[model samples]
Target chain A: MKNNTTLLRVITYVVLISTTSILINDIQEFNFEQFKSFASWSKSVNKNENWFTSKNAIMWSYYIIITALFFWRGYLIYGFTHFVSILKEIEKENYFSQKNINYFKKIGNVFITYTINVLVLQFLLSVIQGASFNFFKELKNEFTFLIPCGLAFYLLAEIFKRAKTLKEENDLTI
Target chain B: MPITVNLDVMLIKRKMKSKELAQKIGITTANLSILKSGKAKAIRFSTLEAICEALECQPSDILEYKP
Candidate 1:
């Protein structure tokens, strides 16, 4: 158990660190310069001042949608932290504790939420930028695997709940 | 929940303390308390056999099915 827990902890740490650093790298690479076009358009439209007629609305929307995507990536990373909490419960011999069950459900919620929101935002951004958005191609991305994994975590939580009741009954049985 | 344990009655008849019975049967006092208090869901055959041996009573004496 110790060996397995240690190995799992290491793997989780590596995943969290790599993901977070990758996100930070993307944020650094994000171009505020893209919004520069919106600036000249902003001045040009000052007489009319209608955002709809602004020449750079698409670029602005693209930046906004991409930034939202980055935040959702951060949200997904937050979900991964719950795995550490679940591992902590296991460390204390509380494999079926309510806290662990809640953590599992929470992770499932986060994974599904992040995936669905990211997909929607990506689609919307593509529509704004006049890019072709392929649903199956997006599904083939590595992150899409989290959907099944999220469902699996919810299943684990339900199974743990049943096991907890059985364990309590067994403990009281003499 | 309908099935109740009458371990306390058997313990009294056998003139044995709960702690003593728990010791003889190789179970903790807390668990024996759970059984005596009718909080236990089920009893294992090995534990039931040990309890019967310790109390010199039948399983029916220590367990009752009340409607």
Candidate 2:
């Protein structure tokens, strides 16, 4: 059991590191300089120009949506940190501990929230770019799996809650 | 809980210590404490039988329905 937990811990660490580096790389590739310039432009631009239809307005909205998407991605990565915590609990022989259950619920919330928020951001991005948004086409993407995965985590939390109760009952039976 | 344990009362009647009864019944003193404190959710039939056999008392003597 210790070996299995160690192996799982290693795998989780690898996944966490890889995803974190990828997110960092993506952030580096994103044009923060352009966002800064946009901010400067907004400060000096013609105040009389229509706010909704101007090119600068569209650019600002685009940057805002991209930033929000990045934020949600970071949040999803934060959710992955809970796996390490859960493994630590298991290593301590606390299988149905309240901490682990709460971690599962939090992961579920993060997963569902990240997915939904990203989808909305994508639709908004498409709209800002004057592209048609296809909802079904978006759902066909890989991250859509997070929806069901989130629900599974919620179910796991509920199961752990039940198991905790049963364990307590068993312990007190005598 | 609706059901209450009267194990301490039965122990007094039988002039038995909690540790001695736990030893006789092959259960830990901690578990006996749980039973005595009415903290146990449910008692197993085998354990109830062992306690009865050790105390030489009826099951009703150790368990009571309060509500």
Candidate 3:
């Protein structure tokens, strides 16, 4: 069990560092010049003009969507941190603790929500960039596995809950 | 949980301390407390037989339904 926890800990750190570096790299590559172009638009422009057709509006929306993607990645990192909490509980010999169960449920929520939100944001960004958005291709992306992983965690939480109940009953049988 | 545990009542009638009964039954005082507090979900027949043998009483003396 200790060996497994050590391996999990290493994996969690690797994932955390990798995602953080990716997000940082993305931010560095983001075009700040788009803001300059947005600002260069005349103040006297017609109010009736379609906002979606404007280059500045597309760039601005793309930036916001990309920022949202960054935030979702951070949320995914936060989910991974719960593994530490679970390991701590196991270290204390509390295998079926309520805290562990809650942490499992929370991780499930974070994984599914982060993946779904990132997918939507990416689709929105594609629209802003005038690129074709393919739902099936998006579904085939690596992060899509997070959905099933999230549900598996949710199932684990429920199993732990049942185990907790059984432990309580066994303890009181005397 | 709806089934009330009357182990405390049986202990009072038999003049036996909770710790002593827990010791005889080979269970912790804390687990006996859970049973006394009616927080236990279920009890094994073996444990019930042991309690009955130790206390010289029937299972009815230790467990009861109120509702």
Which prediction has the highest DockQ against the true structure? 2
- Can you write out model 1's per-residue Cα lDDT over A31-116, one digit (the tens) per residue? 86866866776676657555564545666777788779877888989998998998888888898899998999999999888889
- Identify the superior model by TM-score, candidate 2 or candidate 3: 2
Tens-place lDDT digits, model 3, residues B1-67:
4588899899999999999999998878898887788777777888888899999999988888888
Estimate TM-scores for all models.
0.89, 0.90, 0.79
Per-chain TM-score of candidate 1, chain B: 0.94
lDDT of 3 by residue, A8-125 (tens): 7788778778877887887798776765655666455567887666675766787778667766777887888888788888877899999999999999999899888988898898
Which runs in model 1 stand beyond 4 Å of their true positions?
Answer: A47-61
Docking class of 2: high
Model 3, CA-based lDDT:
0.84
- Minimum summed lDDT over a 10-residue window in model 3 chain B is located at B38-47
lDDT of 3 at A50: 71
Best lDDT goes to which candidate?
2
TM-score (C-alpha) between model 3 and the true structure = 0.79
Error of 2 at B48 (Å): 1.5
Clashes of each: 0, 0, 0
lDDT of 1 by residue, B1-67 (tens): 6788888778778888999998999989898888888877778999999988988889999888888
* lDDT of model 1 at position A91: 88
Q: iRMSD (Å) of candidate 3?
A: 2.0
